[model samples]
Target: MNQMALDKAAVLAEALPYIRQFSGKTVVIKYGGAAMAAADLKAAVMQDIALMKYVGMHPVVVHGGGPEVSSMARQMGIEPRFVDGLRVTDAETMAIAQMVLVGKTNREIVTHLCAQGVKAVGLSGQDAGLIRAVPHRHRSARTGEEVDLGFVGDVAAVDTAVLETLTTAGYVPVIAPIGLGPEGQPYNINADTVAGAIAAALKAEKLVLLTDVEGVRADRDDPGSLLSRVTVQEIREWMADGRLEGGMIPKLQCCITALEAGVNRVHIIDGRVPHSLLLEIFTHEGVGTMVVK
Candidate 1:
């Protein structure tokens, strides 16, 4: 055999144990950021999810389209607003979010999965009461005053019936992070929080978040400071010390939430890297920061 063929065999051998271990287990993937933006990276992510399905791992995708929504809002003459990395969703923004997430983003993901020969169904939190939502009010960190974030929601409960049915019937469920409230009103929920809630509801084996950056870093500016593994306590300390900020704060907070809700592990991976999902799941040396209980 050629040297390259031998190397391929070794790689497959390395993945064997992981495949066996994760077979029949559930993984909730938070798909967004650079992976969703770039065509090549998007293709790689779809391929990874397809491979996971073929190997008997049930992968549920929860997606975010904040950039798309923001762009659309701007086009409609509305300036996008944010509070602590969460979108400040007014009524108009909520409508835009739903339209973008459910109408465009969800269908695109389903089409991509279909191209990979995986059966996928696109859905939103509004479907089948998947995510029951309540109003999410943010407290100003500086003023310590309560702030109203219109149409922004937090997950009150998750009914896993639809998700379970889809996974059991050999379908990958691609979910948009828009929740339904008591009055049947739609609310914009952060994708990271939605992913965590779904993972907790399903008691998933892993909750993997794909981001532009590598992972949790001791120093945000220093690439060499990436922490390959972290515990909940460490993440809390980092947040308390203001070491983690911006979008990273929500990502890590959701990781801690998932861990507390009995998820086995949470991973934050760099989606810019090709086949990063496979690298993180199958290799001994993963390309991400793994959060453990």
Candidate 2:
């Protein structure tokens, strides 16, 4: 056999044990970044999720479409605004977010999975109370005062009954990050936060976050400084010493929360890489940083 064919065989052999180990386990994936933006990466992600289902693992997708929302808002002559990195969602902005996230993004993901020969259902937090939301208050670092981000909310609770039913019936669930408020209002939520909460509620085997950058690194500038694995304690220390900052801080905090809430592992991987989800799950030398309890 040729070298290429031999390598394929080697890869399959390497994945066999992991496949068996995680068979029938649930994996929650936060789909975003370049993976959702690029056509090729989007196809690869859907393929990876389909392969996981075929191999006896349950895969749940939670997706974000912030750029898409902003683009749409701009087209409608509304300028998008942000405070403390969280979108300042007004009533009109919330409508656009819902239209983009639930109506457009969610259905597109479902269609992709269906094309891969899997049963896919698109849903939002409004469906079956899958997510209960409360207003997300942002404390401005510049002013040291609280700011109300209209229609921006945090996950208060996740009801997994619908999710449980869908997965048990061999269907993949694609969720948009729009949550339902106490007064039947819809709020825009962060997809990563939604993914973490869903994983916690389901007690998933893995909560995988697809990001634009490589996993956590000892030095942000050095690609070679990527830490293959880290523990909750180590993450706490980094946060304490100010080594972690910006968007990564919130993501790591989500990871730590998922770990403490009974998720077996959480991974921060570069979604820009083709088949990154498969590589992280099936390979011994994973392509991301994994967090553990």
Q: Rate the local accuracy (lDDT) of all candidates.
A: 0.94, 0.94
CA RMSD for every model? 0.9, 1.2
What shift in Å separates residue 261 of candidate 1 from its native position after superposition? 1.5
Off by over 4 Å in 2: none
RMSD of 2: 1.2
Q: What are the per-residue Cα lDDT tens digits for candidate 1 across 63-139? A: 99999999999999999987767788888899999999999999999999999999999999999999999999789
lDDT of 1 at 36: 98
Off by over 4 Å in 1: none
Report how far off residue 163 is in candidate 2 (Å): 0.4
In model 2, pairs of residues that clash are none
lDDT of 2 by residue, 96-157 (tens): 99999999999999999999999999999999999999998789857979998899999999
